[model samples]
Target: RVFDVLVEGQLAIPALDLALEAGTYTAVSRQYTVKVSDGQLNVRFATRQGATLVNGVRVSERPDKALP
Candidate 1:
């Protein structure tokens, strides 16, 4: 939260709600879009960043193998 207020909050982005969460991250500089497919079975994040994390742990710089 502090990072968004102090650092991210200062960003000149519009309609951007920066939040720390999980999943495949790909917003380079917090710019991207999200899409839901597979009948809520999968989520697609189309962003500029390529960092993906799970359980708050960075698993890879891009989308990792889906865990079953």
Candidate 2:
């Protein structure tokens, strides 16, 4: 399955609850979207000083075992 996310013309991530299953990912700088497939958990992110961190890591798509 595939999911399409659009940040539209906004420059911030939307505040909502989500759950990912496994699929694909697509994001934009400052404003973007992500997609995941079934059985894959949706990863959350936080921006600090223009840097993106997934589960406190400096990169995205980390090992599933490395997740909390």
Candidate 3:
């Protein structure tokens, strides 16, 4: 089973080095919003269930991949 945790209102993903024990793989989509104001930046992630508000971090000016 996939476990999702929210820290300080932000969703935190487990480190990639961890191995999954057993479960059928499923596709999941995550959406994020980045906002900037007064030189301060904020990010939020949204999923089908609900939304998570992130703080103290900003999206990179140049994303390695662009979204359509």
- Model 3: lDDT equals 0.39
lDDT to native, each model: 0.30, 0.34, 0.39
Cα misplacement distance, residue 30 of candidate 1 (Å): 17
Over 1-68, each residue of candidate 1 has an lDDT whose tens digit, in order, gives 11211122233333223443422344424332223233332222323343422233222322653432
Pitting candidate 1 against candidate 2, the one with the higher lDDT is 2
What TM-score would every model get versus the actual structure?
Answer: 0.18, 0.18, 0.21
The regions of model 1 sitting more than 4 angstroms off are 1-40, 56-68
Question: How many backbone clashes are present in model 3?
Answer: 0
Give the better candidate number (1 or 3) by lDDT: 3
**Per-model RMSD to reference:** 13.9, 15.1, 10.2
The Cα RMSD of model 2 versus the native structure comes to 15.1
Clash list (residue pairs), candidate 3: none
lDDT for 4 in candidate 3 is 48
Clashes of 1: 4
Model 2: how far residue 27 lies from native, Å = 25
- Tens-digit lDDT string for candidate 2 (12-66): 3443222233223533233223334454534444333334423222324645634
Kindly give the number of clashing pairs for every candidate: 4, 7, 0
